[model samples]
Target: MAITDAGVMYGLLAVGAGLATGLAGIGAGVGEQGIGAAVVGVVAEEPGFLGKGLFLMLLPETLIIFGLAVSLILMFAWTPFAAFMQ
Candidate 1:
């Protein structure tokens, strides 16, 4: 059997995964930050509206949580290429 250098292939895949996670996190952070700032402004104007503002600000955070879950899943799951290389 010939020894194939699978390191490059796995490295590319890992890089892709890192990029996906980074982009996802950046997007989520921006979204959550905007919402949080808006909520703070709204609450400052009308303290009674704090509850609604808080809920809205928190909603965008779910995307980040989902992205994290996806990252975890990818880390644990077996890739076909990894198996082939083995």
Candidate 2:
């Protein structure tokens, strides 16, 4: 069957959403890699420093959350997706 305009639009939207989330995750992972090694060394040397190390390690995770928010907004609040709902 031939694809309609809405189908094409929806496909593009899905790809955009996937890329947003995937890229964000990759960015966070890249950021965490270095922080993780440093945090491990700091914790090993001084257990009391674990709290600060943990906080630093978790900072990159916000990127993923923001990405998820963007993807959700694109899927649910974008004009084309809303139009298809009705």
Candidate 1: segments with Cα more than 4 A from true spot: 1-4, 81-86
Clashes of each: 0, 0
Clashing pairs in 2: none
Q: What is the lDDT of residue 35 in candidate 2?
A: 100
Q: How far is candidate 2 from the true structure (C-alpha RMSD, Å)?
A: 2.8
lDDT of 2 by residue, 1-86 (tens): 76668988888888999999999999999999999999999899999999999999999999999999889988999986989867
Worst 10 residues of 2 by lDDT: 1-10
Residue-level lDDT for 16 in candidate 1 = 64
Give the per-residue lDDT of model 1 (tens digit) for 1-86.
54366776576656766776777788878888988988899889899989998888778677777666666555556475548456
lDDT of each: 0.73, 0.93
* Top candidate by lDDT: 2
Using TM-score as the measure, the top candidate is 2
What TM-score does model 2 achieve against the real structure? 0.91
